[model samples]
Target: MRFSKSLIILALGVSLAACSDSDNNDVEVKPPVVVTPTSYEFTVTITNLTAAQPFSPVALIAHTEGMLWQIGNSASEALERMAEGGDNSQLLTVDFATHAQSAESPLPPGEQLTLTLTTEQLESLKISLATMLVNTNDAFTGLNAIDVSSLAVNESLSRHSHAYDAGTETNSEAHGTIPGPADSGEGFNESRDDINSVAMHPGVVSQDDGLRSSVLTSQHKFDNPVAQIIITRTQ
Candidate 1:
């Protein structure tokens, strides 16, 4: 999440280069050196939108193409680790990633965290982000393979993301199965004991929602659009 001042200035130069105007009277003008940044500075702002579910530190990556998690596909081990526990180390180190960044701490309910990522060129311009809903079992939010090429300098794009189930683990909601501050239990078991495909997370059914043995309560329940993510071309 650190960028040098020189890199920041160079990014600003690229933005300025993108805005040149040519007059009709000009006989011939050379195109600006499209300093297609071998690297670019991207700013990501994540806001936890849940009322009570705090989010784990966000993981952001830039890749060529391909989603981090596909709806009908099984969750990757890296994703499973993050969804199950709050650890983003494996996800940040996924092989296909061209560049990556991670937040230093969790984003509490209604809190926000901003991070900067730099990647070389549009070849790695696809953006992916993920973070766990700390109150649930294997639930996470954010987008995958979002095209950022068209984003103009200083412009931004924002989205509200829903929770997704890694499906590698069951939604038992038992006393010690759930991770996060609510349970402080174990994370990332090697078992594929649940429905092994990614899907929109069915909101947790806490003790208040009829799951008697559940350690969670009504305060931990959540619905769609759990987090707000904003990306700016802040070279």
Candidate 2:
């Protein structure tokens, strides 16, 4: 066709534009990119601050909801087990826990134990721990659902935990009622003979303090701020 040069160029430009549109239509649409949550790790160290009380293996848990024990509430069987007998198996396997860790051995007076936990969840993340004063009847000390979501990587927090009575057993300090070395007595009895509600432990009354039947001597008595806990976000 004998078209003018300007008209020919215009037609060529139009054709190229159409071709580019066709090519663009043939390009496949890509799926959206998925973002994966990051994993975080935390190190928890527990130190016994008591004079003679040794702590049972500690139960460390990371969860979004719920606590191991609450004041004025009845103790769960899991809490009772740990508080009475120093058994942490039940607490470590609670249904609400996303991740959990346990100390390998009992923490003696002036000793400390470190445990670690990792999880991908950071929203509403909470940390809780529970351990028995093995010489007392259902007395435990630990953190309860302490919020840690605000803690950034490498950040740390420290708290001093007080002793709590599981209220599952009486603080008789009797011959066979305590599981610690002071008595070498029984542990984790399926009995609820005490108040059956959690409350601050009224420091123990030992033989020297007029609780004559108490297998615990003056050395076994303990007061508040029984343990010191330090938490660090490692990753």
The per-prediction tally of clashing pairs is: 1, 0
Best by lDDT: 2
Give the per-residue lDDT of model 1 (tens digit) for 103-150: 998899988989998876754378999999878889999898889987
Q: Model-by-model lDDT, in order?
A: 0.87, 0.94
Structure candidate 2, residue pairs in collision: none
lDDT of 1: 0.87
Q: What is the lDDT of residue 153 in candidate 1?
A: 74
Model 2 residue 191 CA deviation in Å: 1.2
* Candidate 2 similarity to native, TM-score: 0.87
TM-score of 1: 0.83
Task: Specify the highest-TM-score model's number.
Answer: 2
lDDT of 2: 0.94
* Ten residues in sequence with the least summed lDDT for candidate 2: 25-34
